[model samples]
Target: GDQSWTCFLSADNFKGPIAYYIPETWSKIGKLFNYPFLYGRGLDARPGIMGGGAMEINTVPCFEATDAQGRVYSRIPKLQFPVDAQGRAYLVQDVAYYSKAALYDAVKSWRDGGPACSGRFNENGCFKPKLNTRTTRYSQAGKRIAGVERFFDTRIFEGNVWGLQWFTNDRSETGVFPRYFKDEGEERVVAAEAEVPAETNLLVQNFKLAKQGAPYTSPTVGAWANPGPKLGPFNVKLADGSVVTYSWYRFIDQPSFQQYRWSEEKKAKLQAFVEKLHASWSIDRDYMPPPTRGRLVALDPALLVTPPKGLEVGYVPIVTGQAAQ
Candidate 1:
């Protein structure tokens, strides 16, 4: 139970136009809006339970805009990041719950740079700007709606930029190795089903025998591999000049050998290994945290920002074995 966990927000955490727009817009209207209260309620509701929390919040911001009738409407902005076969990330904005005619006008305005409704604006006028816009159909709020979506090439940005959710436990090899490496040895069998020349047939037979005699050796010598490098001790300075720290380690799945033996000796060895690792290693740049649904900013050691106070350390136990389930 000596384990601990903590979360921190860094400059690299924000990605895409919203990332820039959120802080900038918030600077202008954030004071008028109760962000902290809303955030608390959102956290309590626990939306996207299986996904990263704050990252999901960034994708949908409560945007306020006015219509031609001078009516103000507030809606959560829906964004999507679709990656192509080449591994390029693209941003798609979905305009939900709008009339078909209005959606058409919005797309046309964004594409042709004519008088268009600026959702970012609270006033009743249209702005002219060049945009690579497209029309797409998607289901939203239990209804099929037509809306205009915009596409942006995110590679131009230097820091954390938004796109699709890339990091998940299924994709990360934090405390685990590939299943192919789990087994030992290889099998030898008939090389060809068709008949060949006598000399060629003899050669094939010799090769099969040779393979059967030698067999294949497994790369893994033992049941479990070594624990990867330690991550964090990420320190954030509070607005009051106080500092908080966070750290993390991957919990390896229990090895096949230890699954049946629930002995104290095995537990003691595992504990010792964790303690030794904590005492000795640190995560290197080569082993940076995997890309997540949210953007992560690499902090500059020289410039520090004041974070909120009373941040508590969280503990995530990386359990191993069948008992882990």
Candidate 2:
């Protein structure tokens, strides 16, 4: 809980052609359109320092999902980042949570078809129809929908950015980490905020393992900072006055690592396909600027401590059979 999250927004929101408010994904006619990792694309892709020579940069919207009784069960994509479209940069979808494996596979296949996938958008109707240029996935009441699991599926991590590795948890379709991390302890509150200085180099730390470098961000709206495939407990910041502070909270899914030998031809084709996707470009004149920083105070440092300072550290006493060796 002592760790931190990260987020990055473009410099053009205040000066761009349009502004995109991510909570509703393009709610304004003049704002750049944005979507969380769960839905899909809004602005056109530009360029960045990561994947595709571009990256997503923006403030993330946090929407809570709940059931009939108003019991919160799942929250969709938690963050978003931006990419360049033509010569301009725009926020794109970059993160998501898979509450159920069945639903996850279904939705993923519907949007991004690939290995083991069997669904697609127009054919399955998994998504609600888009209402307007600034609208997508609205409820019957026509309000934006979020805060509950309409379908069943295992929770999953769907974003990859920076030069991070991938990892996964083998939880059953009914369970997920981070989403479930809170269940194991008391509630987590946004205890405090630290004002970030502008113009700083960014780096992140994935808690489960040791690695340091620029951290990964979601390509969609509403994402927190994390080490994409590796998972996190991370910290981020802006070092100069040119930009304020950016932070994001990220969860990880580390799959078992291994090597599968591939022949030259197969590897070459795969690499080329990926390259082509990265090369496509456009100019998304619309963009959303991040809200200015209001609070720069550091989080309550007291929250970072373990063992309650003077109390004895808790440890399980392991029993040794026969005191051997």
Candidate 3:
């Protein structure tokens, strides 16, 4: 174990010049899935309400609108991570509609006398209160999020950071950080709308919506689409050198031209059919495989790793490497 200490910070509003003991061993790394995975969010862009004849995405006000409370949602807390479909990682914006809703609900709840404020203030006197008073984290009603899905891990500019939105030098020399949890000393608490986030507050509640993305859809599984066949969500790469995995919502291990003899007439017809299907699908383009000939590694279930007694399922005997079927 190791010992560490920072300046004791209670007077200035920060709960730390933190002091603590640390374990010698670092934890295992985790799978790199899509961060800020907004579960249950409708993938369709928010539609434009119209009084005219055209039905296009022209009328829906951007996520900056004042709510029932005087609190203005001027910015839809945009975040960016370097992950996307074309196997290219770049900074992108994600709006926490759910988080804003949770904040909105917490404000309403506080107005309803839900509970007292709970959280330590920060150096700037801004504290992101725990969301206990509102739909704490996840629920069916009000501004609260459904769960961790609503909460995404991202570099605040990683759109702004990536966009260089903060300070050119403040965020220079080193990367800033990500706010991923609701903390006040130790326990989690919700903040009322009346309370602004204190300077010391690191984590806050939030969510993602689909209107923030392109109106494009995913490809569908066809007779030609196969498990290892490449697909594009961001930029298409016939071949790339990055180490990654390739995961699809459904593996398209269907038959392709290989199953047929060389025939241009038949090939063109089949290609046309496949193209039509691509116009209306949105399968998840996850799973980056290790570099090789690009041949997929399928795992044989017969070799499934079983955990020893007392360990959680799939947590122990961690799934390592790609499947080599």
- The most accurate candidate by TM-score is 1
Where does model 2 exceed 4 Å of error? 1-126, 129-258, 282-325
Query: lDDT score, residue 60, model 2?
Result: 28
What lDDT tens digits, residue by residue, belong to model 2 across residues 134-198? 11122312233332122111121123222211123232121211221101122321110121111
Superposing every Cα of model 3 onto the true structure, what RMSD results?
27.8
Please give, for residues 163-259, the per-residue lDDT of candidate 1 as tens digits: 3322223321222211110001232111121322233222223211212222222223244333321443355444434344433333222333232
Superior candidate under lDDT, 2 versus 3: 3
Task: List candidate 3 segments past 4 Å from native.
Answer: 1-164, 167-176, 179-325
Per-residue lDDT tens digits for candidate 3, residues 122-239, read: 1242222321111123311123322332223222322222221221222111222212223233232223333333332222434455333322332445533443233222222222
What is the TM-score ranking, best to worst?
1, 2, 3
Model 3: per-residue Cα lDDT at residue 271: 43
**What lDDT score is found at residue 222 in candidate 1?**
43
- Give the CA lDDT, 0 to 100, for residue 155 in model 1: 35
- Please report how far candidate 1 places residue 246 from its true position, in Å: 9.0
